[model samples]
Target: MNKVEMHHTIMAAKARKEMTWDHLSELVRKAPVWLASVCYGMNSASPDVAARICEVLELGEDVAIAMTEFPVKSWEKTVPQDPLIYRLYEVVGVYGPTLKDVIQEKFGDGIMSAIDFSMHVEKIEDPKGDRVLLTLNGKFLPYRSW
Candidate 1:
């Protein structure tokens, strides 16, 4: 199965099982965000992790194999339309330069490594309304002078 097929199959199975990412994370001992990313085909899983995911989801070998394959990691060039996603894009668009300046000031001339990154999502309860908290942690790779 290809990534699209695997994603569909996994999502179907998950819905049928009435399973949440947090539940799956508890079962598989992985972060819910990371596991969800793997399921969404944005990231690849190791062979063992793929097998574990398939086993928990009661999926077949094809899905497991597909999960282990590397992802293309491409997205549409246009701005995202989904409200939440679009807001995130908007935040970056508004604060991208500010963030760049602050990060550069602290870390020097370099970039954050998405390849070596971890993200976490948290819900903060409040009387007014719940708030979403996202933490993005990445290694700072300074540019090397050649």
Candidate 2:
């Protein structure tokens, strides 16, 4: 199966099993966000991880093999309409320049490495409303003079 087919199969199995990403993470011993990304075909899984996931989901070999393939990692260039996703895009649109300036000042002429990154999502409960917390951690890579 291809990545798209793999993602659809995984989602269907997950929904049928009524399994949360957190539950899958506990079973597979992986971070929930990363695990979800793998399921969504945004990231590749190691052979062992793919096997473990397929075992838990009762999926066949094709799904596991597809999971192990590297992803294209591309998204639409247009602004997202989904409220949650749009809010994140808006945050980057507004703060990107400021973040670049601050990061450059603190870390020099370097960029954050998405290849060497980890992200976490958390929920903070309050009387008013619940809040979402996101933490992005990436290695800093400085430019090399040629």
Candidate 3:
């Protein structure tokens, strides 16, 4: 089966077994976000990790191999229509430049590396409503003049 098919299988098994990414990651000994991305077909998994996923999901070797294949990280070209995603898009559009300038000023000319990133989602309790907090942590990559 193809990578897309593998992803479908993973999702189906996850639903059938009522498994969470955090649980799967614990079993596979990997970070939840990274493991979730692998299941979503956005990232590649090591052979051992892929095999473990297959075992857990009751998928076959095809899926394990597919998990190991390099992925092309692509998304829709236009702005997202979903409200939550669109709000993120709006935040980036509004504050991206300011963030960049502040970062550059503070840390010199460089960029945060998504390749070396980690993120966590947290829930904060408030009298009004619970708030979703997303924290992104990434390594800083400095520009080098050749």
Clashes of each: 0, 0, 0
Which of candidates 1 and 3 reaches a greater TM-score?
Answer: 1
Worst 10-residue stretch by lDDT in candidate 3? 1-10
- Residue-by-residue lDDT tens digits, candidate 1, 44-94: 999999999999999999999999999999989999999999999999999
Candidate 2 global Cα RMSD: 0.7
Model 1 bad stretches (over 4 Å): none
lDDT of each: 0.96, 0.96, 0.91
Query: For candidate 2, which ten residues in a row score worst on lDDT?
Result: 114-123
- Candidate 1 lDDT at 127 equals 94
Identify the candidate with maximal lDDT: 2
lDDT of 2 by residue, 1-146 (tens): 98889999999999999999999999999999999999999999999999999999999999999999999999999999999999999999999999999999999999999989999899999899999999999999999999
For residues 30-53, write the lDDT of model 3, one tens digit per residue.
888789989989999989999999
What TM-score, computed on C-alpha atoms, does each candidate reach? 0.98, 0.98, 0.92
Off by over 4 Å in 2: none
Better of 1 and 3 by lDDT: 1
